[model samples]
Target chain A: MTAIGKVSLRDTVFQRGRSKERSKLLVFNHTVLLLLTAFAVIPLAVLLFNSLKTELDIGQNPLGPPRTIVIENFREAWEEGDFAITMRNSVIYVVATITAELVLGGLAAYALARKRPPGSDLLMLYFLVASTIPVWMYIVPLFVQMRMMKMLGTFHGLIIIYIAGNAPLTIFLLRSYMIDLPSELEDAARVDGANEFQVLTRIVLPLTKPGFLTVGLVVGLGVWNEYTLALTFIHDPNRFPVTTSFAKFVDRFDTNWALTSAGAIIILFPVMVLFLALQRQFIEGLAEGGIKT
Target chain B: MAVLTQQKPTTVIEKLSDEIWRKKFLRNVIIPWVFIAPLLIIHIFVVAIPAVQGVYMSMTDWGGINPNVNFIGLDNYHELLFEDKSFGKSLNNNIVWMLFFLTVPFILALFCASMLAQIKRGGMLYRSILFIPYVLASVVTTTIWKNLLNPKDGIVAASARALGIEGFEVAFLGRTDTALMSIAFIDNWHFWGFLMILFLAAMQAIPPVLYDAAKIDGANRWQEFRHVTLPGIRPIVLFMFMMVAIWSFLAFDYIWLITQGGPGGASEVIATQLYKNAFQRFEAGYAAAQGVVISIFAGFIIMIFVMLRRRGWDI
Candidate 1:
């Protein structure tokens, strides 16, 4: 009893000493993390602050908080940047690309998973090689080819490109998701005389709603933020999506910090809202899709 | 298909015959291909055919405009390698970039991830905040930083003036010496946080008992981390290393957005070079060669990792 009490007392004493050391480490750890968090966040705060500042204020105080909020900058930016047309354009691209990509990719993923179609391995091999081919490798010929087909500088052209570009990723993610589903329900549906398409839509699709959602979100976000393809194929400003249009706007308004800042904020608002609402999925999906720029 | 399958008799012989038909030409071949054809056709037209055309075009003197393209085998590759000093410089810059990305983000992420992993409370807040930059578009990120780094009316000069620090108001993205590094720094700001979140996730997956055992062994935090945490996350760390290395070659958008590989070709990477060649300079053949070179580097990295795996490395 005496020995056990002695050991307990020693452990408590050691823990007490460790607490002092740990307290110091905790401060150090948090200070470093706090600094990094600021590094990531402060510039964004500055953009928001500058967006509300006048040119006079921005010229005088580059990154300081606004003395008075200038919500008019958003209005000004909206008009001048042509964000009305551009945002609508971006929505079209996002909606069409996501819908087409999900439908096509979902069907392919379904075939790869359930159907185990003949030559599935060959298809997998093709995508594995295709995914590794840099866009630069194909951009020139693709441009020439698009022009040949009269698909360049058109919305359908851009949408077709986006749908194809996104297929490999969508197939890879959704196929893995579909593969894990139990075969019993599918077997029962088949036994009950469900056709292949019916089995897919009724039993498989509903069961894999989360998979579809993930593919939709990933493809939607990619199409929305896409720059290089849009920059290349959609040369007409009338058809410019928000990103390419915003880039041009920022360049033209180089000195108009308030306007450009407002533009940046407007471009990011939808993404921010969606991200906060779906933080987990966004993080996980991006982590998995880290190969993308 | 299912209707035909459903009409089968219960006899094993009948069921066997039906299963054979279903597994063969009907179920396995025709029906599956019907479902797969749409996506396959799209991919073939958009990616495969163009890619094959690109390879063939790379060996020619195609200026991207004229219908006449002359085949000149190995000339584009020869010129890119021997005559293009800018290619070498850009290649050097890419190397510097790969080095920067492979180290800076890894360190920052490891440090921040380790620190965040220690704190249970408010960890989510810090992570979410750190990850915000990653979610922002490249245009927005570049725009935000360009203004911040602008010489006369930017945060750098303004803050320096506020603090009475003189002679630090140089143009970061304008000067040749600073341009590539500046773009890299901006890209890292948007990138490291994502790395932090990823590393933190891997760290979280590490068994707590490992830490407990390390503590019982009188191992300090550094020792514990070096011995346990590093090994625990080796696969993810190495995988990210390979990914960052591959991505460094393809680094574009930010550099293109900010500088367009200019202010005297200071920040020209392969992709930017390829873009300018195809669109601006109309050197389609040369640009295709550059693309092939970039892919070769990326493929080489993949090959190394694959070979390492073949050699029984856990990664």
Candidate 2:
């Protein structure tokens, strides 16, 4: 009985020591994460702070919180940066690109995942190879082609390119998602006299809604944040998306810290909101899509 | 009339079977292609054809818009190889960018991701916060950093002055010496979190049993990471290394947005130089050559990794 008591006492001591070490490790991890969090967040906070500060206030306190909030920067930036038109254009591009990309990519993904037509493997291989081809490899010729086709400087033209650029990613992601789903339900729908298209619509679409959502969010964010293509294709100032337009705005108003800061915030606002709300989807989808693309 | 009527029944059976065969063929074969056609066609039109044409374009002296075009085979490549000083500088800068990304982000991300992987509580918050910068547009990210790094009245200057750090208030983005590295730093600030998140996800996917086994074997924290965590996440780590390496050559948006390869071409990467050549200088053929060179570099890197994988490196 005395030996048993001693062993139990020793066990408690070891357990306590282990717990202490674990907590120490946890504390260290938290500290590093906190510092990194500050590293990641502080610059953005500075931008936000500067956006709220007046010009004179920003000069005095560039990185600190504002002494007095100023609302004029937003108004000034909105007008001078042409946020009204550019943001609207970006919205149209994001929505249209996501819509078309989903429809086309979903159909293609469904076929690739389920139907597996003649030469489907070859088609898949083509996309896999094509997806790896960088935009730099083709941009110059694509520009010429766009010009020849009279698609340059047009919204639909840019949107079409966006859809095409995102197609491989959408197809791959949605195909992976669809492949996991049970084929039994689709078979049942087919047996119930549903044609292929009807089966896709009534059965497959409902089941694969999450996949679509993820693809849509990923593709839409890409379109919203796209820079190179928009800069190359859309030269018309009125047709410029928020990215290229904001780039030009910053160039013209480089010294106007408050105005530029506010413009930056405005451009980031929608994305920030969507990300905060659907962060799981955004993070997972982007992580997957980014790796593949 | 009686013999023709008897043959009609057999003909009906043959036609019915033929119809069934046709319907089965349509459902099984043609329909899927129909489904795949639209996006595939768009992709071909936008990417595949242009990519093919770019190779031929590289051999020509088509000055973007001029009706007169002539094939000057290999001249563009020859100039890029021997004569073009700017191209040399840009290619060298791309190498620098690649090396920086290959080292700094990998170390930072691997360390932080392993640290985060150890913590269960508040890991999500840290991840989401860290990833916020990645979600922002390149324009916004560059703007935020540019303002913060502004030599005059920017935070860095202000803080340097407050700390009495003399000569630390120089315009990082405006100077030739510091421009490329500085832009890389800014790009990294917006990028490393993404790598961290990727690493973190990979780390989380690693089996807990291997970690347990390492612990049972009396592995120290570093040993545990080295033996268990590292190998477990090797595939993702190696894949991302290749990707980051490829993307380094294609690095354009951040550099273009911030410096436009400026302060006297100190940060002139191939992509930015190619952009200027194609759009501004209207040397479309030369730009096409540059583009082809960039793609070849990317492809070569991919090939090396693939070759290693095929040779059973397990990477």
Candidate 3:
């Protein structure tokens, strides 16, 4: 019970005071976070909830729980809405475009990273500048070109366009990741009697696998969900992507909430799965690519 | 033995020169060209050729199908700038859209990200939930909201009435005054998630040591935020601002699908205008001119951003 004991007691009281303040802060933080979460999730919840309700129920009660589950809406949306075809087209478009983008984008990135060739810096600058220009600027001329070349309504044309359109960002991301790789690895490979091609194939490509995966997943997600270009270029129903097909539900019919909601749910499932499967890489890639760029 | 050794040295020099020539040919000439060829070919056909043709088409009166197009220089620009009344309104709407789209969400995202940074649990869940809207295509989002905002029996209207707000049953998407704003709000809801994720990522990039130092210096949360977090995310904020501005100018999908610039051309932005002019009205030349105008504006905004970035603004 000396001076040291008294000081320790005072410190304990001060800590209690700090704890109280922290508790108050914590409550405030939680309230704000809860509000944000609600704000973010309400629309999705509404979509899901309404999809389970009949049209009469949705119109009459609006926000109340469904009187009965209606799984028929999804069946209707799938068959009549041509969702099967749209899904097939979407898969084709995404796979073809993503594959092309990764190969071309990765090769270009590898060359630029290692060679430091003359005007390589200028090439990178060109991509940066090109990214800022709106794709709409080229839409009309592209349409005309496609029409003239008899490539309109062809999957090849759309795939090629998608690849070229997404190339700038893909290359930019891969190059940034490539720049961070250890130069010594390439030097060591060269010392081991590897040519430039061997260095790229055996060493650089293998090392940059993470970057490739990140770019592929990101680009795949974008192409899968793309709408406007698909709407514009792909007029044939057989070639329409998921977005265009879903849009048809709205265009042809009145406000059939059940079917539209079901379509939305179907459309959302893949993207959600994609994000869930690659959540870590996606988040990391987004952080790295976005902040740096 | 001396003569043979001397000859060996000369022969070795010749072989080395030949090897150098072959390596140089492969490395300096072929590889770079090979690496760049695919991209260059695609660019030339898809981007460069169309760009040139788009400019060419701007001078003509092509209806997008006819082979023959009468050259009509600057007439489309004249109509858009001077004669067309809706064009001016659309332009003004675009300005408002750009401002709100870039600023409000950005400020809100920053605030949310900052608040979330103080929390320990469920941060990733919140982030993923917010980002859900961004992953949905514009068509799906617009469709869902259109149904939700239905004037007569839509959930939003019903809910508003349930809360005792009179006249909340108004046809939000049908009227001119509210249509643009309503569309903008939906766009905000759809897009804010991405911005939140960006801000959150940028926030995480900030070192914890800065906050620790600020705390030791007797800074409270708000003060530390102002002194530390704001400065840390300034570059991202600036970059997002520029991007949002560009996106606003180019935005078409949601507006098109939701309202079709309708209730008589109320929510039309430049991109929508270009689309209507080209596809609906069959004014390909006029649309091309409008496209050029949009491109020039985009070019101006990008130039400013690039100049600022060069001056260390980080965008």
Candidate 4:
């Protein structure tokens, strides 16, 4: 790497005199990138700053850094926003959806990728068409159906919807991954007196762990950040997820910027940490997921 | 061989092949379906059946409760198309939203992606930073922007005061004139970065040798981009265009969370109208019609793209 770097450096040095325009363009690139970065980040910085400020401080220094750091806004927002309940509810929705989606999606993907059963292609086509259908198309009838089944305002009900809503993406992504895996290991495992289930559990599962992780992250993020279905199906405040609950909190305290900022931070904190920690997975998975509701 | 009692075979080889076929049938067909059944059943019930029911319900006066028993055919659609003024306004707003999204984000993302592609150093860092907003929940994004656009104490007010500019601190989300566009701008802010990252990925995949060739041929940066980069990224660009056009019609969270289609129905879109009609007005049939309308619009966009593809557009 160092040798390659040295060679590139020497090449740049040799080309520097003739390619002054290149350096000028680099400056222009950095300037525009910096401005775009600021455009993306400054509002978030202000939110963080306002979260630390008091109402009085925000009144005076609204978009600037806080004059005094008041840690109590988080405490106040936490209690007032009922974040304890909402956060737990969101986690339950996310975790349950991921678990169910992985198990069911994994099974389905494995069958599609390896077994190649009759009509599997038809099923794949079904999911592809189903995925393109907007949620608005079915949300009203689904709400009535959920109500008829007495599943409204319930965590399991919401989880079931999330699992189903994410089924297409999950199956598509996991099947693509499983399709790339060599089948020799499974054939060898079959020779070792392993059943199909055993081959999947022991061989395919471990080999395709990264696929599961990617699907898990994408589905999990979708459930965590979901708003429309949560708002539609969950009328009970106590059962509300973080997204819906935060919207309600903002509604009640639209003018209280400090408290709202702190509330926003509370909701954002976990997502941000996870994003920064596993940005590559997050970015690639979401990009692959594409236009999720 | 002795347990091959399920089907009678006249010959030994016939029995042998029969046994193998049964085994393959069990292992391949039944088991796979079993594995797929749980999720597939649930998805079919949740999405498929309801979607089909939604089509039927749009023709009925279901009223969202009491299990009403009337099937009035196409009346709701008639009302939506001819009678409902708000639906027309909302559909118009959605078109405006679609137009803005198709143009602004594509141009912004393409320009920035090309610029970022030129840089070798800190490209990853810049990409990550820009993408941070996309990872954020819509709730959090709207909250941040809502405060920043607060006419009373927002950055606009503060900066305008500092610069001695008059009449600059307008309520962006308050007035009917600006509410829809302001919300679109905020949504775009959280959104365009994702598009930039996507375009950047596509740009990176164009093979550096193409750029080298372009440079060797005395091509300027813009010329190289126009010819090499754009053509290389055409498929993804076109695919995203269709997806964005579909999503623009389905856009709900940003507008709902920010304005709730308020300030005199300024930012209302089809989905928002559908939501209110179903939940608030208890007009399930009407809303289902709206939902179908939205789907028709999306399907229409998709069909156009399909037609383009069939015409050898290379999309």
Candidate 5:
């Protein structure tokens, strides 16, 4: 009886010790995570704070809370910097490029996924090779072509260039997703007397909405943020995209930190909202398409 | 008898003709062509034309603005390779940038991913916060860092002063020696978050049973990590490594905005050099040649990646 009681007592002590160790570990983990979170959040918070303060306040008390939030910085930035035009240009460019990329990219992807055409595999390989090629090499030549065609400084030209540059990867990603779709569904559509066009539009397109959304979001973000091509091709200020316009703002020696930061924040808001709204689909798409190759 | 035979023969020929008409050629070929034509036109006009033009431009002596250009065979390539001192410096900087940027972030990300994988609570929050920097425009990122790293009245300098390091200010971005490293550090800051999330996702996809088995075999944390986590994430690590290598070679925005290839061209990467030659100097031909060199280097690295990929590193 005494031996049995002693054994139980020992077991209880050991269990307590293990529980204490586990709690310690949990605390340690939480502390580390909090620290990391602070590190990540601090710089952005500082930027926001600076954006709200006048430049003098920023120079004086960099880390301190703003004495008075200057709400007029955004208004000033919009008017003086012509950010409204820049924003419009960004929207137009992103929308046009994404639409063309999706339609064209989707068609190519469907062909590769469904048709199994002769040399389709070779075409796919060519795309992979093309996607990895350094785009800077093509920039000068593209510039020359745009000049020759009298398309430089035109929105239509920018759209064409953006679509062409982005189509290879977009097609690659869309194709992968389309290929994963079950063949049985397509076969059933054919059995129902649906021709290839009907199958593509009615059946495949509906099912691949997620893939389209993913491609659209990624490509849109890239086109919106692109600077080099825009800077090179769009010599006219009126035709400048948001990125090139922002770069011009920098070059003008305009050190209005509040306005600059406000503009940055404003530019980022849409992308942030889009990401938050479609976080799941965006992440899944990136995981599947980006990591696969 | 003759009328009955002629009517039967005509009916047979009409039936065969109807069957042939049903195999619609337009449906098979034209429809798909209609769908594909837009992308094909854009690709041929924008991408292919320019790419070919870039090659031709390399062999000529063309100032970008001038309509007239002299065909000077191999002169631009010869100058870039032999005469240009800055080109060599840019090449060296690119190499260093690739090494530091690829290895440091990769290791840090792996560690962070492993730790995050062990935790269950607040995982999504951690991931979102980490990925915030990557979504910011490069211009914004560079602007913020420029202020942060300023020699006078910058937050970092002020903090150092507060910590009793009197007059301990470093013009990191302005100095030739430290400029490249500073730019690299900023690049890592903006990038590490995205990589961490990627690695975390990869880590989470690894099965828990592997760790359970390792523990059952009397393995400790380090041993379990080696036996389970390392092997599980090897492919992801290799893939990310190659991506970092490629991206580092292509690094431009931060270097361009922050340094502008300044402090005696210490931070002049290949991309920036290419830009300067093409745009600022109006040496379109020379820039094209430099571009070809850049492509060759990029192609070499890509080939290595492809070979490794083909060897079943990942499919």
Candidate 6:
């Protein structure tokens, strides 16, 4: 759009007098960015700080650094809120749902991506339209159906819902991944006396482990963090996942800010660790998932 | 002659084996369908059939658990339109929430993203820190804010007391006037960071040459942002706007967790109202109608996007 010479254009970034002005601009940029960053970060830090404080200390210094560093809140929450059992339940849901979504959705995605089964276009359109169907539209009937089938208050029931909800995500992402893969090896395996099942398992699955991993992470995080369905379906306290249970736990211990913060941190700890460890992948996957929505 | 006949017999055996090996029943149809059936059946059971069932349920007066359903055509719709006060209020609140989200997050994200875009150093630090809130669960996010907004010991009250700012120590969530705004503020705190990331990515994708071009034209920072940044990121921004508007109707977790749409139905939204009707009130048919309405609102937004695309708006 500009006829300026390339070197001059590049030089414009720090042109003599402009360097001082640019530096000042950089300071302004950092100040605003840092302030906004603080707006995001401070609350989390306070959550963490409050989690480690005594109830008395928090009452005195609610939003500030804790006067006493106490680790007892975590123990109290685990004991009182039943984090031990809830965490296990959450893990089971996450694992079962992710596995179901990946295996089943992967098979379907492979069929649609490469095999192009009859009515693939129709199936694609179904998913395309279904993805936009608000969960509220169907959730009531789904609940009714689950109730009729005696599936309400079950982990498997919730997992089934999670898998169904994530199918579009799994199919779209995995299909794209399958499409990207050079299919020469799959063909070679087919020629080498392998069945379609063998080719997928021995070749496609292995080579596309990254894609499966991404799907697993995305779906796993979703199921783990899910609330509304878990709230609706799993009414029994014994089977409540971390999210639903922690919600009730927070409300029950509403006055106990320290215990509440600790419980919240416990719920967030694993996700935060995984997020920080694989931020790029997490961000990429979230962006991908968000884009689809 | 006998040897020739023997060869013909062997050839016939070979032909029979080949026919069995290439059965059309298994190749083009059965195997592919096998791969597809599981996902299709599960999806149909969970989403499709139920969604279809919801259309029927919307017309009936069936409590969720009741086996008997009385079909009353468009009655729920009639009541929703004419008689439902909470529904009307919830719908209005949803619109108000949508307006806040559409403006507040967009402004904050655009400002923060543009600022981050200008500087290279520590951008990742700022980006990741800013994004941390977004990754946290709604329960956790709301809990953090609930403490931060606590009337007595929370940040606002503490700060006011410290700074001698009189009459600023109001119980934000407890007051009907401030409850919805407070919840929106908390939700926005957890939300705007996400939009910032999206905007930042879009901004970064804008070719530097465009900025150089703008600079060459003697465009100021505001002018450059208006011309270059806005045009470059318009698609994502507008798409996100549409989504936020749709999502406003479906807002549940934060409000449900924080207030349960309480303090005089102040922050009640469509999804919350739907939940209450379906489960709490046992008005499944009414809830189904509400759900359909929420879907219609969402579908209308989607339809607008689709129509705009069809009209060659390029968004």
Winning model by TM-score:
4
Ranking by lDDT: 2, 4, 1, 6, 3, 5
**Per-residue lDDT for B1-315 in model 6, tens only?**
354335433587787765664554476567988999998898999999999999999999999886888999999999998998888999899999999999999999999988887765566778788888878888888889888888898888888999988887888999999999999999999889889888888888888788787877988889999999999999999899888988898999899998999889999998998999999999999999999999999899999998998999978
**Model 4 Cα RMSD, Å?**
2.5
Q: What is the C-alpha DockQ of each candidate?
A: 0.48, 0.51, 0.40, 0.63, 0.34, 0.56
| Candidate 1 C-alpha RMSD relative to the actual structure | 4.8
lDDT of each: 0.88, 0.90, 0.80, 0.90, 0.78, 0.87
**Where's the lowest-lDDT run of ten residues in candidate 3 chain B?**
B1-10
True contacts kept of 2: 0.79
TM-scores of the candidates are 0.93, 0.96, 0.92, 0.96, 0.91, 0.94
Q: What is the interface RMSD of each candidate, in Å?
A: 6.3, 6.7, 7.1, 2.7, 8.0, 3.7
Q: Write the per-residue lDDT of candidate 1 for residues A93-153, one digit (tens) a residue.
A: 9999988888888889999998896699999889878888888878899999999999999
Off by over 4 Å in 6: A1-9, A12-14, B1-25
Docking class of 6: medium
lDDT score of model 4? 0.90
- For candidate 4, please provide the TM-score of chain A on its own: 0.95
Model 3 DockQ reads 0.40
Tell me the TM-score of model 6.
0.94
For all candidates, the clash counts are 0, 0, 0, 0, 0, 0
The order by descending DockQ is: 4, 6, 2, 1, 3, 5
lDDT of 4 by residue, A162-213 (tens): 9999999999999998999999999999999999999999999999998899
Q: Model 3 segments beyond 4 Å from truth?
A: A1-16, A191-197, A287-293, B1-12, B309-315
Candidate 3 fraction of reference contacts recovered? 0.51
Q: How well does chain B match by TM-score in each candidate?
A: 0.92, 0.95, 0.90, 0.96, 0.90, 0.92
lDDT of 6 by residue, A181-201 (tens): 887988898789888889888
- Runs of candidate 2 with Cα error greater than 4 angstroms are A1-14, B1-10
What is candidate 3's lDDT per residue for A1-293, written digit by digit as tens? 12222332443466576666765876897898889888777777888888888989887877667789899888888888888888988999999988888888877877777766678888877777666657777889998889899988899999888888877778778887788988999889888999877887898888889989988877787788788888888899999999988887777766778888888899888888878877777766665555434
lDDT of 6: 0.87
Which CAPRI level is candidate 2? medium
lDDT of 1 by residue, B1-315 (tens): 668856947899988887787667776678888888999999999999998888888999999998889999999999999999889988998999999999999999998888888775687788888899988889999999999899896878778978999986989999999999999999999889888888888888877767767878999889988998889888889999998998899999999999999889899888988898889999899888888888889999999999999999998
